[model samples]
Target: MQTSSFIGAVDIMSTQTATERPILHGGRREAMREAYPAAPQPWIDLSTGINPIPYPIPTLPAECFTRLPDPEAATRLESIAAAAYHVSDAAMVAAAPGTQILIELLARLLPQQRIAILGPTYAEHQAAWARGGGSVDLIPDLDDLPAASSLVLCNPNNPDGRIIPPARLRALADHLAARGGLLVIDEAFADLADRATSMAATLPHPAIVILRSFGKTYGLAGVRLGFALADAPRAAAIRTALGPWAVSGPAIAIGTIALADPAWLAATQHRLTHAAATLDRLLTDAGMTIIGGTPLYRLAATATAPDWHDRLARAGIMTRRFDDHPSWLRFGLPADHTAWARLAAALSGNRPPLANHPDQ
Candidate 1:
């Protein structure tokens, strides 16, 4: 659902959907409002890959809010995260506010190293590397990767769910390591993905740094917790760069409990799977070609993508429209039945009656 007014513009929409779709903040909401001035009162924001259903946050101790974050609490969070991510040692996992920070940190650590990023993935990887002074190449083909100091990519890639196999990754890792470089895998979207393909399951490697996102998976993007998994020495380097008390007290408390709860993760995974299936049916029904995406979102292609995007926007449904890939529109799952029905009607070109306005 396009909850356009959810975030920084939560005043324009409502606080409820903003909480539901936390990733889309006030600035984007305002931009959407400007883009579609006559858009409905509230939007069903499908612009982000964040899960609408958030983790059930347990009550926090008053200290979690009042006191400075403890080093021990941070350590506990890493340990629990290691077990949750199937990592061999907690020492190899360094916790940070978010993986976005870790991405830049990793790049800056080895500045001026030429980087090869598997293309059309997350734009952030390229941006971060470039900022860190690395000459970046956007490589599209997996058959032949350029010889760069590091190979940066996502596992189940963003925009297009092109998953590179572990055997292939191992070979790449070997090649990069032999060249005295690194293989950075952003497993940000891999929490709900296949565990068998995760690089986190293997022992920590000097050449491999697996970035993990906490907020996107748990639907608690506001809590702001992520990890960088690497060899102990490398992990220590990340921690040092992070300085003291980098992870907030609330984030520590929340992440510790969330990562420790397997039952909730499993239940949420099932729910997201069902939501993705429903979304797939809805998109296909509306004559859109399913291009790619993980369970959290679907990438659809249509010759009339611009028209479709405008139509949906007018009807208060905000799907992701890429400037580069104008034919592509990424749809995050509709949060509720009203959002679902509205999306369906909009996509089908059957605007709901004014009498049915509330749900329509």
Candidate 2:
């Protein structure tokens, strides 16, 4: 799927040079507002890997907010997550407001030394380590990781979906564990990709910690729920660092229900797979080279990625472009047929059909 049959055919303003724009993250509609004041209403945001069709949220009991989060409910949520992730022990799971918080906590908990992060990843790992006063390095491959006291990487990586074999990662974890070092694996997108690549199924190691994001897969980022899978001591340390009531009552209730619902998971997986394939077809039809991505999103390599991005933005269709990788652009799956047609028309530089009106 790297090269497309429609290459050099679609007129996406490919000849026009686009002005360099500041890097912006997905779901930041306000940023888009400032960038494109009169583009359109209800922007079609395809910059993030989050599922466009969010899970159906259950109505919460009033007590979810009136009272403090129950420790037992939090425990139950962790247990559900543990079972969902195939964690060997429920005690190994620690619930947090978000995995971003857990990443900071891990950076603070782990010993300060050379921390190597697999390159071109979610930028927070390096910043979080720096915030915790830990030294950092961005290594391109796993072979260059031995010298670092702690190594962090996103499995089924962000922007471009790259996955490291579980066995190879486990060997690295064992090596780091033997030296009292840490190996952090961010499995944010693993829910939609190959689940076997997750370290959750592996036996707990003193030096290994896996961060699982509940929001991305479940499409409830507003819930701010995430989990850390680690040995008891490390899990306890993260809990202690986050303090009491680290996760809200509503979050626990929602996470427990969502993670435990195997039926919903299966259905959503199928829906996302179908949606991703549709997105691939749409992008390829627009002459973009689909390099790689998980079911949640597609990454394209193109000589005129910037121009395509600009054209799309003008049409109120937002996609992610990397500052470092000028030729690369990432597109998340559109929510419905209307959004699909809207993006297709934007990329092809044609007006969206009136019948397939863009939804707000």
- Candidate models: Cα lDDT each: 0.80, 0.80
lDDT (tens digit, per residue) of candidate 1 on 1-360: 333233222111121322243333222556777777788869888877888888889999999989998899999999999999999999999999998789779878866478888877776677777768788877888665777888988988887878989988888888888988989998989989888778987757668999999998898888888999999998999999999999999999999999999999898889999899889998898888898889888999876676677788788777776655656778888878889889888878542233422331
- Tens digits of per-residue lDDT, candidate 2, 4-117, equal 211112211121212222123467667666777777767998888888888789999999989998889988988899999999889899999999898778877775678888
Give the Å shift of residue 105 in candidate 1.
1.1
Instruction: Note each model's CA RMSD in angstroms.
Output: 7.5, 7.9
Runs in model 1 deviating more than 4 A are 1-27, 350-360
Model 1 poorest ten-residue lDDT run: 7-16
Taking all chains together, each candidate's TM-score versus the true structure is 0.89, 0.89
